[model samples]
Target: MRHLRSLTRTLHKQRIEGVTFHFDPHHQHELSTAVRHFFTTPEQHTPLDTPEATRGVFLLEGERKWVLKHNRLIHWKKQLQNYLGLKKAFGLHDLTNEFINLSAVSAKSACAPSVAAFGYKGRFPFLKEEYLLVGFLDDHCSVDDRLIAHPEQASTLLPQVFDLFARMLDEGFVHMDPHPKNILIAPDGQLRLIDFECCAHSVIDHDFSLGFLMGYFFHYWIKRFIAMDDYRTCCENYLKVEQPTLDRSIFMPVFERFLTGKVSRTTRYAILTSPKAQAAFKAQ
Candidate 1:
């Protein structure tokens, strides 16, 4: 549960030169050695194949497993999205989006994997990259794909997915890029989220959170993972859990946009930019 607690609580945040480091107060001795091993022996790390738009390495030392989520140092070239005023919408903020989202979630929550440490400057030597440390899991895979292959599993897992989305709506944060790949299925059937870059989505208008949910559930045109009817049923289930008083008519526009955009090149854009999705955000 230490990993699930407030990241700023036990970790001592320090800055050396231009790099940042977080030392675990509870495991100072163990963290010191593990951090060094992860940074210095990058070659021994095995790369995890992420279908989501993310890249990271899995490091093993003795019996511990750690996953280091990484991103290259930013340059003026990386600022083009900012110039276009699409930074937050695209989750390109300097603060790692995953950390931002995870920090807002309750420690006992099952929505995401607990992040261990933040701002680890990797030893690329020739180039620099920032990493977020996450405790490596034992056995897990994409929950979305697993359901498609084993429809029977959906009987129990589908409701859990809907419940998670409803809770997120009530909580106010939204995961911008809604890809099934971001959700993982544990051996016991619990779900966990990973690859947090897209958590920084939507600025003033919070309605897009619903769009995120729609895309997350249906994946719309990209993979056509879930049918429109299935998504509608999901919406109904969501309304019951998050807003039982609201009628289905409330989501018509979002549904219409998704259906129309499915054929158009702008389906993704349409879903994220719509004005009636209604979920507010608590992440700062």
Candidate 2:
């Protein structure tokens, strides 16, 4: 069942049971049917073990691999705020935010995936379900996997990892969740970023703090396996790439807070107690 119809200039749209779908004309031929089936009969799709978002894979022989992100309604409080017109919350619609984020990031970086199609499966003001289909980078492993298998390579890889974040920051974007798992290492040794569902755009004209970026690295990388010295090397690499004038001294407070568990209890507990973090700790 081909559900998509042409709009204009590489755009196509489809509507099914109150849900609307948008697709790239270049990929319409390959994506239309698979997208329809993935949404209409989600139960048949096997879920992928993604840490941040619910995902499912729908592979086709001799074709590009497709991964569908099932965006669940996790931030109810934010959704409520959006509904009440109290504040515009980004969490109200995860798939839509990701679709937009991916588009913006793709325009600036080759490392981000191209969104093939996106759709929502509910009425307005109370969207119940949403999904995004994207071209999967086949045979790539998460940065976490690579770092785990070769702890000694942290010095070599952390700089490349920081470079990726530096580029994104230079492009006026912050990947609110730039954890190791959300970043992938392609067979060619290039770093590609995925899972932009929590990404946000920052003002290009303003000087930005490295607090959030450092926090994510500290939580996912330093706390898990990377030595403090290697992590500092990565931070210096990032400074050289993006903010040469900024003092490394500024990072110490945040870094020490994270290291000493003096940061917010919620964030500290979540990172230290997450199953992925636990597994990484056990493997050490």
Best by TM-score: 2
Candidate 2: worst 10 consecutive residues by lDDT? 1-10
Best by lDDT: 2
With a 3 Å backbone cut-off (N, CA, C), the pairs that clash in candidate 1 are 207-278
Clashing pairs in 2: none
Which stretches of model 2 miss by more than 4 angstroms?
1-10, 16-18, 37-46, 50-62, 72-87, 91-93, 203-207, 233-244, 249-284
* Per-model RMSD to reference: 7.1, 8.5
lDDT of each: 0.54, 0.61
lDDT of 1 at 166: 54
TM for candidate 2 is: 0.72
